[model samples]
Target: MTRGKLFEVAKELLNRELLDKDKCYMLDCHTEIFVWMGRCTSMTERKSSISATEDFLRNEGRSTSTHVTLLTEGLETARFKSNFVNWPKKEELKLYEEGRGKVAAMFKQHGYDVKELLEDDHEPLINCRGTIKVLQVNSGEAYLIPLPDQSKLFSGDCYIVQYTYPGKGRDENLFYAWFGRASQMEDRVDALSHMYAIADSTRGFPTLAQVYQDNEPEQFFSVFQTLIVFKGGKSSRYKKLIAETGMPDETFDETKTALFRVQGKNSNNMQAIQVDQVSSSLNSSYCYILQTGLSVFAWIGNLSSTEDHELLDRMIEIINPTWQPVSIREGSEPDIFWQALGGKTEYPKEKKVKQYIEGPHLFAVTLIEGRQRILKEIYNFTQGDLTTEDVLILDCQSELYVWIGRLSSVTSKEAHILGQKFLEMDILCEGLPQETPMYMVVEGQEPPFFTRHFSWDPSQAIMHGNSFERKLSLLKGGSQQSEVSVRNSWPAGSRGGTPEGSRRNSISSNGRAKSASPIPNVLGVISCTSENQLPYSPSPAEVKLFAGSSPQNGSSDDSLAFASSPALQPMVPPDNVRVDQVEGSDASDNLSIYPYERLKVRSVDPVTGIDITRREAYLSEEEFREIFGITKTAFYQLPKWRQNKLKMSLHLF
Candidate 1:
């Protein structure tokens, strides 16, 4: 689509009270179409067009005259109003017989102009070849005025006239034309004139590109500054406008240029500057200025006096000053301008991780690629022995690991880079031990079975292996030892290890499971027996089958370990039990377990986040009283600050 058509559609959409729901439609109909059409290459063009259209309509003034212009020859018989409804066909038309007469009539009745032509012997009106002009013809008067001479005018220079529109083709384009002084006019085909036509095609209203050219910079000067001022505020509207301008906020440096200044309170002698809606009644008046190629604000007056107008005049003088306007000075110290206003500690910035060899510190380095890997390989070479003595190897591959390991500490950032270096290699050609301690065999000693073939193969690293479980399996322990397990509560009396409260578990020949506790152990295994077996074997969907432990046979002569303790008695009857489907519960949960300290339970709190750990649950009255005893009377007697002090000292009590 032409820029004009797109603009027209945009204008119609923008004028309406856009609802939240209309945004998607706007993107689909307007934004996406322009992108698909390839009309909007950069954000600048679309943003500038939208802004110009909005501003043009917002600032549009009522026209003082109703007359319209038309271009035609000065022949009497050629003038008539019948041509308004139908035009003489282009190929078959004769000028005096139809075209000239029809166009002239409209000019006589209304007022029209021929911008660049005169009546001649051959044609009704013809001057320069292929040239158009503006004409002024009233019912009683007839004459034409040629376009002004601008051979010497410079680019960006413009003029407005009380001129009328020419004939049809001219009206389609020429909203306004710009011209340069003679020597600067570029070659005469009215290239400057085409700018206006381009601008006119854009819909809604004319923009700087349509109504004024870069040569006509004056038309934009005051309005341009005003646009920036309007956009330079903290409000959401101003923020959006600022974004539309494509100007970075950091570019508006205040140090070198006095673009903005805040006026003192009680300043009523201001000119056109508007007050911020939020604090309009404040004592000080804030005046913004665009003096040295940047935007800044200044406080113009105080409560005792009103000197706002005087200050504005002074500022304008600084900006425009003498009749010969000079270019504003650009800022030299870009670093200062770009520096954040509130000092360095403003936002969270990336930090380099640190690595340390000994103490409580442990770091992992993943090898990336490059010479860094070679350096890391050199360090791994000396892993056969580690001694307190410091050893130094200068870029040499021999005795590298022992020399580096002696260093007191290293930053995590260096370790991370080293890790990246390690990953860049192929096979197990080179390797370096991470800051994390790994058991290594001495040069002449036999390595343990578990460590026998452990190679530093980056490709074979397991991302989610349960190292704790693997290590637990490798640990030496008692014969017929119980598997490392986890329980909601202590396994009967194992917590404090009391005698009469001791818990006993029984195992049978088969791999059946059983748990009989006061609470039915919430979710624990049950052994299968012919006489006392559950009516049906628990399906996978029903009860979870645990590994390791089996059920005991019901023979009286047997140890009957399941009945050795009173605490093992089942508290809940089978009829009252409700079973939730084991949807995503992990089967690994029934495998080798972990110690209590390593286990975690999670509960959700809808409004907050997941509340884990048994300690988060509600406490009984006695428990609450026990916690409050330390603060009992002191909290009530203390002042608010002291109370806060005590509360913040959470562990001191």
Candidate 2:
């Protein structure tokens, strides 16, 4: 679609690969329009923004007064760049442009105007407004007959319905032979042979299908205006008549359009309601199956979830099992889809509820001494505010997101169950409905919806800086600090997801500072990940993972709170390394407080492929390699259990 013609791509499907350096694209984000021109684009193509916008507006039935902005590669706005996944840094653009001067020259000579405009022909033979004829056959031969009133049929008869689209360049015929349940087999065989004979002579070979009684497909019911069944068979009342045509010239009729909503969370509760075919009736929280003429489309709403998708899939199997149905997600609807809904208009962007839409609220979920525990809200937060050890919740209006770091104690399962309860509690506590859509995303898999809240520098994608940072550090005579800073240096009021206290950040609104103070060692006595711990107080615990009346404080209960993985703590320094530089490292017992069971065990030799009693880690990677032999990458490729077991066996844990 990026080669020459303008087209829409699903927001979920948009990524860096779609932005080819040799092509151009226009993203229509409802109210706003952005035209992206690649670096190697031709001069003619570069100046075609106005024409493109006009064509786009005229096609989409939008006003010409709508704003259209132009953007070039590498100089795109933060909002534009956030639309894609794994969006490359500007340095990658520079590198690609470094060797493309000659390629640009060659492209300028020909330009994009020479490219062919591609389109598909959609004139279907099995349409309602086309020429339709019915044939009746006994044991001998099939003969033409007049259309029966209400498509009334007798149980003892066999019939062939032949559909043709005349004077539309689609001369081929569409044939369907329907056999009644009580009809004789010999009569049905004779009808099919006669139907194919006429079809071969008419237009070489035509599209044909077989339909049995009581097993009609959606197309069968939709193609025919009405259907009625009787209890009798062939009689003397049968008469042959001329073929019939209804409103042949009026091809695109809205009366033939049907819209069905495929909704609900599970099979037992799912419903497919036949709603009015209009933009106003469209819901953003459900998938809709629309039938425009013979074409079918599955319009996926933005607010619909994975469960809805599965329901839509089942609905599709019933509505258009064999036919090719166009699957289009919300915001990327095709022009034809808009045409079916009488041109795009205002529609709900999310599931409507009694509660008013509000800005996001964040919470941290942490594990206490290897036990999952709930933490409270974080004030004045930022992307750099999320720690590697704690699980954070981002309540984005109607949508909620729970982000788990790579080193967080909460596994995907634990997050799905407990993180959900925490989100529900947060919403219910605030007097809002608990039916808001929730999603649990892991580190690096952060969707654009979640990432857009941050005003991220492409260079700061990783914990460490890019090559530019390394070069800058070299020029500054290297950093004097021994340990790397856990958070990025950013001021309040900068970047999206600036946490709950947007303008009320700890530092002055305009001042530059790290997102928050780095996590404190707390005398190495604290074992949990949270630095700003809020009390659960004396509330009754919802989950019985730990047995006690109170959950805010640690108890002697041995039961695991959802999981057994230990909560990540601050980076531990070796005994020889001095830690006074870090806050609260002056304590005599600088080592983190570990469970008594771990300190008493002997070192485990996991690499030796032997099952032994666990002990304090003593083998270094060099000794591990000398003893067993496996590269770090290979070890990483092993199953997570193997990797975690190896790490636990080593003193590293």
Best by TM-score: 2
lDDT accuracy of residue 167 in candidate 2 = 23
Per-residue lDDT over 406-464 for candidate 1, one digit per residue giving the tens place of the 0 to 100 score? 12122212222223222232112122222111121111111111111122221112111
**Candidates' C-alpha lDDT:** 0.24, 0.50
RMSD of 1: 39.2
Clashing pairs in 2: 453-496, 453-497, 455-495, 455-496, 601-615, 602-614, 602-615, 603-615, 617-651
Candidate 1: misplaced stretches above 4 Å?
1-261, 264-625, 628-653
Please report, as a residue range, the 10-residue window in candidate 2 with the lowest summed lDDT. 517-526
lDDT of 2 by residue, 1-653 (tens): 34346676566857878877777788877665677777677656755654666677898899754655555565464445556665654323332322233333443353321111112222212335566787777656776777643255555577877766432233435566777655666777776677666655664224455566655434444445334444335622221111132212211233478677775435433445555678988878788888787788988988777888988878667544674778998889889888988998997664532222223556665443333354545545566555444577776545566777655545554554544455444322333234344455554334334555554332233332322222234344554222222223222111123233233333322232323212221101112223343222212323333345133454333322433434433222223322222211132123333332333324342333211222112233454343225543355454433333334323233
Best-performing candidate as measured by lDDT:
2
